[model samples]
Target: MILPITIYGHPVLRKVAKDIDKDYPELEKFKEDMWQTMYFSDGVGLAAPQVGKSIRMFVIDCSNFADEEPELEGFKKMFVNAKITERTGEEWSMSEGCLSIPGLNEDITRPEHIKIEYYDENWEFHEDEYSGFAARVIQHEYDHLEGILFTDHCAPIKKRLLKGKLTAISKGNFKAKYRFTLAK
Candidate 1:
């Protein structure tokens, strides 16, 4: 199933997500839905909050960048109840966009490396470290679990300039190929 992504201004996007255990209802099915929704929406990453679920879960697949980064050829994983234990290395800027905030991409700066502990879709625990593009993608999705958006990291002036566009998005005035739910 392709879940409808919650658009900007959706209340759920602004709330911190809660952790879920192995007994989470239909966990496997939900994870499959998330993957379907993300792929359908042309997103490399998607978080639970973006799909109107307040749970600490997100999925990422960077295989599309395999040509550019061979290491990411098979980098696909689901993160549950993830916690970033550390962020190190110099910061770099890269353009980032979210499925929830479609048609908007901003140059966001983030650390180059991160250490995170999380459970896979099978509910198996694992702690791992990532760098470069992988780290950036992880951080972007992680922000969603913390009630933060990539635009929030933009310069003050950039935000002010984006106010009109963001308001339009909140009002369902933007175009997106995937299904979305606007704030009521």
Candidate 2:
């Protein structure tokens, strides 16, 4: 079922999510629910906190975007208690937006390449190295697990300028416009 996605000003979005306990048998179901929530929301990624659950787990499906194609074979992935094992090379600037902070995109700098270690649906450890848009999406969701939002990494001036707009949107001032835009 599609879960209600928490908005930017929600406290849960700022809270550091708890690590997923491997012994929890229901995590597989949770992953399924997250996937449904993300797909229904038309989001490329969704973190547990976005659904009001403070857990270090998130789902990613890059296939939804028409412009970007994931180089990896296996597309949809769930990361439980995921961590970045290594990040190397120069940082690259990418325009990023968040499910929590809707309608705003900011240029943020991140490592060009990253190696992430995470547990799959079966609770098996898997390590994947990624770059480009895929890496940016994973890193963005991973930050949610650590109580970090994309705005936290945004350029200071850009973020400051968007503060009022963000607040207004959160207050439902832009609901009508948002609905129309989302319809497209």
Give the winner by TM-score: 1
Model 1 ranges off by over 4 Å: none
Top candidate by lDDT: 1
- Identify the runs in model 2 with alpha carbons over 4 angstroms from their true place: 23-25, 64-74, 176-184
Lowest summed lDDT across 10 adjacent residues in model 2 is found at: 175-184
lDDT by candidate, in order shown: 0.95, 0.78
- RMSD for each model, in Å, please? 0.7, 4.3
- How far residue 7's Cα lies from its native spot in candidate 1, in Å, is 0.3
What is the C-alpha lDDT profile of model 2 across 28-63, one tens digit per residue? 677788888787777889999888889889989886
TM-score between candidate 1 and the true structure: 0.98
| lDDT by residue (tens digit), candidate 1, 1-184 | 9999999999999999999998899998999999999999999999999999999999999999989889999999999999999999999999999888888999999999999999998888999999999999999999999999999999999999999989998999878998899988
What TM-score quantifies how close candidate 2 is to the native fold?
0.86
Model 1 RMSD vs true structure: 0.7
